[model samples]
Target: MSIKVGVIGAGGMAQYHIAGFKQAGAQIVAIADLNEAAAQAAAQKYGVAKAYGSIETMFAELPDLDAVTIIVPNKFHAPLAIQALEAGKHVFCEKPPAIDAAGVQQMKDAAEKAGKTLMFNFNNRARPESFAMKAYAEDGTIGRINSAQAKWIRRTGIPGFGGWFTNKDLAGGGPLIDLLHMVDLAMYLMDYPEPAYVLGQTFSDFIDDKNFKGPWGIPDAGGPTNVEAAAHGFVTFKSGQTLNLQVSWAELVKREEVSVVFQGTGAGGKIERLFGTDGLDETSIDSCELYTQEGGNSVNRSIVTEPCEDMGRSRSAANFIYTITGEEKPLNTPDQALSLMKVIDALYESAKSGKPVAC
Candidate 1:
């Protein structure tokens, strides 16, 4: 049986989800957004049967929807997921799952009560390069991971400086949340370590420098901004593994880059560069070079590329439907998302207190 789906929000990301669902064989039954016209336009473009101005109305009209994709802004993620689960529909929500820890818990509770699947759209995990790295780490090819480093830097890429992207109340934090995919990927590759402590610092000096490049298409001289343009954090996991994270939007450099390095006791490997949704046309490197001391000689082994399943936004949406139909497990469960949010919360707390926060 084909799963019935509804999509909320008609933003840029929404199109990705709509296309993904269509490819996955799910029926786009309804679409809703605050802007009725935008919703109608998306419905027409995606061949959805119904369009509404709000989720409540859509749910009322399309009660048979097997799942709904919540593609709204960061703040609305939790509430929308909870509502969908309560209405007996599985939820595929965008990342950061919630704005804070409390919000994360509420969504988890809602899913538990409804006995429905709730997933966060951590699409980076679907990348072929990410899968290769995971396989290398899991196969003991990298030995016991001792330390890890991840970096996400952009030359001058501030988003919506005076709009919701820069608004603390709307988007939560700046690069911390905006570029959290790298952070989540690092943590996930490291076996989802429980941070024993976190020491972090955030900076917003560039946002007010009057020389930053805004990615959200917002003009300068609009108004004041209230979000960080760069952030860094040091985390010590309960297993004694350590991770260093660095992210930025308004850096004094060129090119947008993402990479992660893992140091193991016997050998170490690093992923130099990996393309994401931001640039699908670009070629991706799914290979890693490992260095090890074997038989008193420095041995370097280069693992070549292996075929991997593409689990982009569409694949994730399809997985949501499969999980709802009991054909597969959710790509990202509520518990896993809540854990990621907890790490995010700890990073912020540590930044504010100027000390290490225990997870």
Candidate 2:
């Protein structure tokens, strides 16, 4: 039987979830959102059977929902995921896991209690380049990674003047949280080692500047711009591994770039995306390459795969469905999410205290 799915959001990200679920042979039975009109419209557009103004209503009506995919704002991720997990349903939540580590731990505990699968949309892991890089890391081609540098920097790319994207309470801590894909990817390639501490700093130089707004066209919602515009951090792991991360929604730079470069004992590899326009992955050029010595000479090899325009957004959703059906293992786990959130929380704390914070 096909998995019966409920989508818990009517926002822009919902479309990808719906499409990916349906493509993976799941039945998207309903969609729920606070805005009834938006929910109804999304249901119609996506050929869903039902729409509800609230998650409670949908759960009450669709008692047989096998799973739910959460595409809500950053603040609501943990609460909604726990609600679904505790109800005996598998959950696929969007990134950052939660606003902080404690919430992700709570969600993790809920899923453990319910014995249900809890996965986060660390979508970059689904990218072809990521797949290739991970293969190298896992198969001893790259050997043990000693250190890595992860960057998701933009020249002029704040989401908006003021709104959830800029509000610290709503979006966590801006690009350090929002653009954390590379950091996660780097850790994934390195096998998610236990982090020891984080040393970091944040900058909000252009948080309220309209000129630095991204090309996504999200209108100003007129709220407090309390989030940082950029962040830089270094993390040391208990296994003696190290990672450096730089993320920013707005900064002085040549172009928007997303990359994770790692140096391993046997070789070095890099997965990078250089954007022609900010926030549009389709317009960006991507490359994956490995550096090593062959026969006492320099050897650089390009690991090419089929192009990914959406940066594996829908594919990440599809992976959740595949995991539930036992066709594939999950790309991300709730435990890993807890650890990642701890690192993020520590980075923010470090940025605030101007000192290193234990993870």
Candidate 3:
């Protein structure tokens, strides 16, 4: 039986997600967005059965929505996910999980109470380069990870300046949440360790400056301009592992970077996804390399990786359906997402206090 999925939010992210579900052979039965035109347009484009202006109305009318993909803004993640879970629908939420730790915890509790699956859309982890590196760590080739460095730096690329993306209250934080995919992939490659503390610094120099912004998202001017444009932080895991993270939305760098390099006791590995000068689409090359010793001599090996398992976004939809149908165990569980949220919460708190914060 094909699973019936109702997608919420009809933005660029939602387009990828809907295509993924369709490619996975799941029926995109309905869609809902605050913008009615967006909802209707997405529904028509994807051949969805119905479109609604709100999730409440969609759920009330369509009583058999098996799952929902929540791709709205950061602020709606918790409330919307909880609502869907309570309505007896499995929730597939986007990255960062929620605005803060408490909000994420509420989503987790609601999922548990409703006995529904709550999964995060950490699709980058499903990329070929990333999963290949993950295999090495799981196989213990990169034994007992001690330290790692990761960066997802974008030069002059802040999303929706003066809008929710640059508003602390609306977006939770800036680059910390916006470009979290890099660190999330790093943590996934390291097997999801429990973070013990975080020390972070955030800068908001270009929040109101259009010169250092991109032309991707719709700008909502006249909103708050009080969020960081970049963030640098380090997390100490309870298992004595550490990771350094540097992410930015605005900078003067020559190029953009989305990369992570892990150093461990046995071997080291790296995953890099590069973009062009314009930073619109990813460049053709992505590298996944492993460093180890062969016959007592050091060797740097390039791991051969295929394209992302079901194309770019389909893997996430496939994995979620597998979880629903008991074919595969969920990799992005609510507990795992909550762990990431704890680290995020600590990072913000540490930035505010100018001191290390316990997760």
Candidate 4:
């Protein structure tokens, strides 16, 4: 039977989820948004059977929802997911599961009590580069891991100064939350070690500036900008491996930088990505490369990119559906989300206190 899915948040991300659900052979029963017009439009565009102005009505009216995607802002992730799980539906949430660690825990507990899945969307884990690096790390092709460095720097991308993207109350944080793809990918590739601690710093120096605007933002004339525009942190795992991460929505740089590099005792590899017209197309996607000592000389070679039938967001959606339909199992569990949340929560705390925080 085709899974009956209802998606909340008729925003840009919801469109991707709608397409992905279709690709995964799930029937999109409804689209919900606070803006009823937006919900209607999305329902029509996605060929969904219904449009709801709120989750309450969606549940009260249509009780056949087998699954629901929580695509709303950071603040509502926990509550919405909890409600959905209580409703006995499988919940799939986008990245940065919640604003704080406690909220993620709540969602986790709720899912457990309901005997439902609480899969977090770390979609990049399925990307070619991320998948390849994971293989190298797990198979010991790179030996014991040493350290990892990843960054996603956007020179002038402050994502809607007045909207949820820039509002601390709405977005949770700036680049740390918005550009979590690279950071999450790197950590996922590293197998999400037990983080021991985090020392970090954040800055919102340019939030007041009207000159810098994001490539994708709803410029509402001018509004509040209360989140950090940049953040950098160092996380040390209990196993002694370390990860250094830096993310920025606005900076004084020539261009953007997005890469995940991992080092090990024996070999090292890196994947640098370039954005393209259609997201990360073949031309823009980086090749998985390895650097090591061959005989008496240094050698750098490219690994063959295996054919992946589904990847990125589509793969994530398909896998979620697969797990629900008993076709496959889930890779990103709520426990991993909770662990990742602990590190991020520590980073935010460390940034404010100017001290290292134990994760």
Candidate 5:
């Protein structure tokens, strides 16, 4: 059976989801956005049959939709996902499932009541380099992991100056959410260990300063920006593993960068210089080098790059459909999303208080 999917946002990211869905052989049945013309344009572009100015109307018209993808602003994630789940549609929402813990909990409760699948799109997990790193960790190639470090740094990459991207209320935090791809990837490689505590800080000084010259050559229009341009955090896990993470939209660097290093008891390995272009046509070389603590020998492995596969968004969409059709187990349940949100909440609290917050 073809899975009928609806998209709730027609923005830049939505196009990626739409393409992934089409490539995965799912049906794009409907779409909705606050901007009706944008929704219509997306529907036409994707060959979807229906477009609506509101989600309520879209649900009413396409009641049989197998699943829906919520890609709207961060604030709307919880409400939109809850409504879809209550309507008996499985949901695949973008990362940082909700703006806060309370919203994420509500969405989880709704999914539970509806007995539906709810997935947060942690797309970074699907990258080839990420996959290879995860396999190495599980295979004990990295030994007993003790500490990990992940960083995503940019020279001057503030997104959508006057738009929701820079607005704290609309997008939550700036680089924390924008560059959370690394956070998700690092934690995942660490086997999603329970975070014992988090300590962090956020800085917005550069963004609002008039004399700021962005690292990426982006001009700094000095003005009030509500979001942080850079953030750093330390996370301690229940298994005694610790993670140090740094993310930034603007910095004193020349190019964008993302890297993860894992230190283990037996051996330590690192994946450095990882990132991808917008159209999926280009991606950073993912390389791993392993060093044995006991032997004092180093083995560097170059990860072969293949055509990037749209990591599981469409497959995740298909999984949602299969869950509804009784063909497969749920790919992402609401419980998982709630847990991810809790981590986000703790990270923010730790940042604000300059202390470790228990998760």
Candidate 6:
């Protein structure tokens, strides 16, 4: 039987979820959102069978739904995911799992209690380079990664001056939370060691500058920008592993760059994406390479893979479908999301207190 799925949120992100679920042979049965008109429009556009104003209505009406894909804001992730899990459905949610660690823990507990699969769209892990890197790491080609540097920085790339992306309550803490893929990728490459402590600082130099807005077409929502424009942090793990993070929506930089660099005992590797036009993925170049000492001589070898257009957004969503069907394991677990959120929480706290915070 085909897996039946419902998508929450009629926003742009939901379109990716709908397409990906369909690509994996799941039947998209319904589209649900707070705005009935938007939900109806999305359902009609996608040729889905139903549209509703709320997930409660969708769940009440479609009892046979096998799963739900959540593309809502960071604030609603935990509540909606728990609701779906309690109603007997697997969940695939967009990241930064929730507004904070406590919310993520609640969602994790709900999924465990319900015995349902809960996965997040840590899409970078589904990229071809990431797949190859995982193989290298598992086979000890990269050996044990002791330290890593993760970055997603841009020169003039704030989503908008006053949109939800800049609003702390609706979107969490700007680029540190929004562009967290590289950080998560770094930790994933390190096998997700338990974080012990974090020291961090944030800057709001360009938070209110319209000149620093990104090239993406998100319109200004006309509100105060309370979040940081950039953040830098370092983390220490219980296993003696460490990670450095540098993320920003807007900063005085050369160009937009997304990358993760790790130093392992046997080899060091880097995965990077450089954008010709900031905030535009289509105008970007992706590269992966490894640095090692071969026969007492330094060697830098480039690892090639098929080009990725969406950075594994659709592929990661499809992985969720495959996981529930017993065909593949999920790319990310709820526990990992919880752990990542704890680190983020500690970083924000540390930034506020101007001191290191324990995770």
Q: Enumerate clash totals for all models, in the order shown.
A: 0, 0, 0, 0, 3, 0
> Model 1 — which ten-residue stretch has the worst lDDT?
276-285
Best to worst by TM-score, what's the order? 2, 6, 3, 4, 1, 5
Higher-lDDT candidate of 3 and 6: 6
Whose TM-score is higher: candidate 1's or candidate 5's? 1
Best by lDDT: 6
Clashing pairs in 1: none
Q: Rate the local accuracy (lDDT) of all candidates.
A: 0.76, 0.91, 0.83, 0.81, 0.73, 0.92
The Cα error of candidate 2 at residue 39, in Å, is 0.4
The predicted structure with the larger lDDT, 4 or 5, is 4
Mind giving the per-residue lDDT tens digits that candidate 4 earns over 1-359? 89999998887777667766777799989988899899999888877889989988999998888999988889999999999999999998987799888999999999999999889778777666666777777888888767999888877677666887777887788888777777777677677788999999998878767566765666654546788888999999998889999888877766677788888787998877654422334435456789999899999988777644334776787678888888887868888888888888899999999999999
Q: List residue ranges in candidate 1 displaced over 4 A.
A: 214-224, 274-289, 293-311
- Of the two candidates 3 and 5, the one with more favorable TM-score, higher being better, is 3
Each candidate's TM vs. the true structure? 0.89, 0.98, 0.95, 0.93, 0.87, 0.98
Report the lDDT tens digits of candidate 5 across residue range 154-228.
665665454676777877778888667667667776767777888888887677543443322223333336888
Model 2 lDDT per residue over 1-359, tens place:
99999989888888888778888999999989999999999999988889999989999988999999998779999899999998889999999899999999999999989999899889999999998899888889999999999999998898876778888888887999999999999999999999999999999898788889998836799788899999999999999999999999889998999999999998999999999888887779999999999999999999889998888888999999999999999999987898899999999999989999998
RMSD values for the candidates in order, in angstroms, are 3.0, 0.9, 1.7, 2.5, 3.7, 1.0
State the TM-score for model 4.
Answer: 0.93
Candidate 5: worst 10 consecutive residues by lDDT? 214-223
Error of 6 at 206 (Å): 0.7
Worst 10 residues of 6 by lDDT: 215-224
**Candidate 1 lDDT (Cα, whole model)?**
0.76
Candidate 4 regions off by >4 Å? Answer: 221-223, 276-285, 304-311
**Which ranges of candidate 5 are over 4 A from the true structure?**
209-224, 274-285, 292-296, 309-336
